[model samples]
Target: MSGKGVLVYGEALVDIVPATEGRRAEAVLGGSGYNTALTLARCGAKVAYNASLSRDTMGKRFRVRMAEEGIDQRFVSDCDAQTPSATVESIDHDGAASYRFRLSGTAFDVAPPEPADLSDFAHLHVTSFGATLGVSGQAALALMRRAREVGLSVSYDLNIRLPVLPPPDQARSAIEERVPFCDLVKLSYDDAVAVDTGSGQDYERWFAGGLPLVLSTSGDHGADLYLASGGMISAFVPASEVVDTIGAGDSFMGAFLASLWQNGGLGPLLRDLPEEISASAMDFACRVAAETCGERGCKPPRLKPKPPYD
Candidate 1:
């Protein structure tokens, strides 16, 4: 509980994806937090996953996956209800994917947090989807507030899914409500454009008061890092072969957090980072993301030890 590591709080669900060359389907243990936690654990980070699951087969499988990946499962809560599941449609030639969630009264919706049990984590990463779950939003916000009160650094991934919310405006409002609570924010190029100005240049002004460090990912074109001190860094690393783009963004986030953990200068780096150093971090994270895209799922390739400074 007193570890110098990150705790990922969100849902742990199963992804029912179509198999190659046929109509057969495969159920994979996947979720935003689950993918990020697994990626971080694979990259040799001490990670803990805080999610709610059901006392069902899928939940057991999810727990087993976490154990195999060497992630700490002490925070996984089990309830009597069933776990959420997503049915992912077949992938297209561009490696894009679509999904239909079969979520209703899942365990995450009813799970409550125990503040005393989570005060020891050094950092907390919350997904946008996790914050919008029924009643889970209140629980997650309460936990975030408690973590912030105790001086834990917070990161938020604006992994927006339009279908989950009532409307596009409502979704944007909900995500905007949580921005100020996060020290680090991650968003894709499309997400940034949609949430703010249609141009990526306006992202800094959009969340100027809330996020100190913002990461914007442009598929295939690489990623950009913006610091609070008027510094901008960008990196471009093209993919070798994109098997699927389902969890590429999550992989980038996992690597970004790992870099900050190893460097131990996240606070200063966020506020004022040299362009070259920030670019290097983005380059390393880009490699992590590209490697993940080479695989079929969210599993990221092992990362080599990077130099301390660029």
Candidate 2:
């Protein structure tokens, strides 16, 4: 009983932006996995989200948002705990936003039941706090292994949050253990440094470790894609006005996967990826992320309609 589309596995939570001047604090839909699913669905990729949501107001809002965005929710289950939240820190001049997460005892701290089958998905994408801590972390690790056993493609986004994660040494050890299960790994340069301080600013080790692609996004300086075939593609976002850089990386990962999947390259990405495909996908991903940065929060932009022809 094979199925189509991607399975997104991780936490689903809200981000509370602090009040500024006349505006009051606002709660926005967020979480790496949820944002990725939104971006994927908006980019025209079929997506199924697998997060256990609480029966609270925030969780109800999440359900509405996902439904409005056209995401599949059959895999989403219910939990008795309260919804998790992250308080957004001050935004820097460059628009980079940090966070202080309230995750302990939240719905995400509890692992959802396993999916009935792995054949219901073609690709699996995991990320963020849920992928690194608590019962959810164990579930994520097990799901990744199951995906591999079913021959499904997998991508891991190391969107590490130092404040909420374990010590660097333990965090690094945990993340490295999951790398071998990934066909593609996406992380920020800061996350890379946090993972392995001695990586010497080079991600070749990840590429050489059997991953077909290792993508690292550096704010403003743009993103770098390292290929297992010893080739590198660097993409720089064109200068654009910024709002807040919340969810920028999640949008990038989602768009990158969407581009590959839409262009018929996702399934064979690890087996035989053409240089042209990687280059095009990277460019598209950067453009989408840039658009997201212009928005207020994690609200990713949809692909613009093509101009009518004569």
Candidate 3:
């Protein structure tokens, strides 16, 4: 796994949940990039995480979690600012969580890093809409550009949170700027609706413009996969008890990429992915996502000696 596997870049933060019905106030590990890296490692994919962590207590928690999960932390740097946090405001009956963040001056909001060797990784993944704003935006763009130069497959998750980003116009601009570098773009149907530059909802247009794949997931209603080659495939969500939807999309992405890697379709092969591999990966992803929805907070299931596909 030294010169192979996935390279993940983005935020690492804590989610503070207020006490609710017999539960005490608590903090949990989160952040789109953090959850995705954790899921990738648990799914048996070698993963290198590159996010700035503060020296604060929360940051220490993130470090420990990464170590316990066996994630590569070679590029996990430190910052003077405190770790960012998001306080859960409410959980609807459907188990969807809403949040309010404390991110100004936090570790992830700092200046971008100088370019480094990206030649080792097979794929690059970046998430969180907040990561597409300000300094974080610069970091994402730089990594994506560098990954492309090195021929690494790139994926972006428009995990948009209107609460933590700029206005739609600015957010759309920042987001659009980075999509051209991506081979795959994963977003919720809501995200497509929220950040539509009038074309986000037009799946065919995205492919016509060069995106190889676009996965639009809608909880319970299911997910849709559109390919640049031709056709769209719809996958149903595997039934599972809903605990919370904190990292459903992250887990889906992790499993999807893990499946592709296992089947030898993660790199150049991804551009002309076989229909069988694409369908199988989508099913594996949906299963992983449903399992995460049954957990407390982004705790993905292990896919080792035996995986769901097996």
User: Which candidate number would show the highest lDDT if scored against the true structure?
Assistant: 2
lDDT of 2 at 160: 86
Rank list by lDDT: 2, 3, 1
Error of 1 at 128 (Å): 2.9
- Tens digits of per-residue lDDT, candidate 1, 1-310, equal 1247788877677877778865456787788888888888887777888878888999898888889888987777788898888777768786767878876777767664454665546788887587655687667777778777777778888776666756667766777667677787788866765555224454565456656678778888778777776667788778889888888888888887776666553433444445554565677788898888887767788784364563
Compared with the true structure, the alpha-carbon lDDT of candidate 1 equals 0.73
Please say which candidate is ahead in TM-score: 1 or 2.
2
| Order of quality (TM-score) | 3, 2, 1
lDDT of each: 0.73, 0.82, 0.81
Which regions in candidate 3 have their CA more than 4 angstroms from the true location?
1-3, 112-115, 197-201, 304-310
Query: How far in Å is the alpha carbon of 291 misplaced in model 2?
Result: 0.8
After superposition on all C-alphas, the RMSD of every candidate to the true structure, in Å, is 2.7, 3.1, 2.2
**Best of the two (1, 2) by lDDT:** 2
* Model with the higher lDDT, candidate 2 or 3: 2
Task: Report how far off residue 161 is in candidate 2 (Å).
Answer: 0.4
In candidate 1, how many Å is residue 197 off?
A: 6.2
TM-score of predicted structure 3: 0.94
lDDT of 1 at 53: 81
